[model samples]
Target: MIIQLHGRRHLLDVDLDIDIEEFTSHVLFGPSGSGKTTLLRVLAGLDPLDEGELRVDGKVWTQGSAIKVPARKRDIGLLFQDHALFPNMSVEENVAYGIPRAKRGDKRGIIQWALTQARAQGFTSRPVASLSGGEAQRIAFARALARQPRMLLLDEPLSALDTPTRESLRNDLRLLIHTSGIPTISVTHDRTEALVLADQVVVLINGTVHQIAHPSTVFEQPADAQVAAAVGVETASAGSIVRRTNGLAEVEVEGARVFAPEPSFSTNGVLVCVRAEDIALAKEQSVTSQRNQLMGVVTRISPHGSLMRVDIDAGWNIASFITRTALDELELRQGSTVVAAFKAPSVHLIPHD
Candidate 1:
């Protein structure tokens, strides 16, 4: 399906053209207040566009001041951050409530099918109040499926749960949505979620579309500096290509030399982008195959989820993510000296104009 949406909302001025393959998941990803949810809501018909047009599959859904189709007739199922299940209702009742009046004739069949699809059939008779966060989310998903929507809009589907529960539900949700054959658009600020759930990722920042590509491309080869920062390229610095040999380019950033694959573009200025996870920390300079090694002092160390984010300063700032075990073994501290090593291929160079 093809969607062309152009409009303005509170803190949002968007112009997007998207093509979604049938049964594939598209992710709207960006930092907070980047208008990810706003775009999703507009597409769901929850809000009106100030001045623009929305067309789906060559059909106009909205014009400058007119809405051709209202929210109820859009055939979309939306799941919010909160599951929004009724506390007084049973799991079965909650799922049944989402069934349209036309489909209530086969209520039992529809409910059972949706619950089974969402893997929530076992809790059909359980009280909503007694269910866990993950269970409640599953019930909400089951309800959404009962509608048999042509499109699904999920706004932070797993954000309300704890880390472990979120991770587990993320996997289940991806499989359920794909197998159900429903095209989905999910909004998230979590990089891991975008990487795992999205067949295509739309990176929005400050209410603008910065990049649209596969998750790997968006994270590994950002289109520009804004997308690099939005997608969390932890170690990015302004540099210039000082020399090129064979297929390798040597870049200089604040007196520090970094080697990377040559860019296809003909340019001397570049922005070196490297993920924190790609950098390796060592207590001593070891002879390895890594093409780039910088001797730096540990400036700071902070907890990053299950890992540690170590900040170093060789001639410029750099960051690396390492496990706690490695931190302790390396004896890293605020003043410890260490070697940061990364292969040349790990460095992604974006042409800077």
Candidate 2:
């Protein structure tokens, strides 16, 4: 299905166009209050487009001041962050809620199939309140799938769980979404969630569509400083292209030169973007295949989840993530001198205005 939407609603000023192929997933990704959920609601026909139009498969669902189709008729399977199950209902009953009364018997097999596909079949007879968070979410997913809607809409479906539960469910959710053979549009503010679930990512920021591309492209080669900041590209330094040879460009950032694959756009000045996780640190100038190595003093060390973020002032500021074990082994401390090394391809340059 071809979906096109151009409109303004609340804080959202969106112009979105995409094709929904079978078994594909598109993620709307951004920070909080960026209108990701707003756009999803618009597509689901819950929020009318205040000033424009939304067309699905060339059929108008909303135009100017009217919603041609109501939310109930959209045939969309929606899964919310909270999993909104009925506490009094058994897992089986919750999954059967959307089926028509006349056809409930005919759809029983489908309910069982969905429960099996979601890995929630074992607990079908249990009350919703008795299920764990992960199990409850699985039941919710089964309920969404049981209806066999044309497309699925997930609004931060896994965000409410604890870290371990959320991480474990990520893979399961992706697998089930694909297994259902339904195109999906999911909204997420978490970067890793977008990376894990998105075939295409629409990067929204402050009510505008900043960049729309694959997850890798959105994270690695952000279109502008706004996108770079939003996607957590930790190191960005303004640099000038000093030379171009054999498709590689030499960029000078604060008197330090680094080789990078030439950017597609022709610009003398570019923003050098390096992900902290892509950098490697060494106490000495070790001989390795990495093309860029700059020596500097470690200015700060901060805990980042299971790793430490080591900030180095190597002409320009550079951040490298190392495990706690490596941190202890390397003896990295504030004011420790170290060499930061990273591959040439790891440097993504955005054209500077």
Top-scoring candidate (lDDT):
1
lDDT of each: 0.89, 0.89
For model 2, residues 1-353, the per-residue Cα lDDT tens digits are 88889999988998888887732998999999999998888888888877999999999998966889888888889888889998888788899888756667777787888889899978877778888888998998888888888889999999889999999999888888888889999999999999999889989999899898989999998999889999999999899999999999999998689999988888889999999999999888877999999999999999998889999998899899999999898888899989999999999998885
Local error of candidate 2 at residue 309 (angstroms) = 0.7
Residue 332, model 2: lDDT of 80
Per-residue lDDT of candidate 1, residues 247-319 (tens digit)? 9999998769999999998899999999999999998788899989999999999999899999999887899
Error of 2 at 299 (Å): 0.3
Best model number under TM-score: 2
Instruction: TM-score each candidate.
Output: 0.92, 0.95
TM-score of 2: 0.95
Runs of candidate 1 exceeding 4 Å displacement? 86-90, 100-102
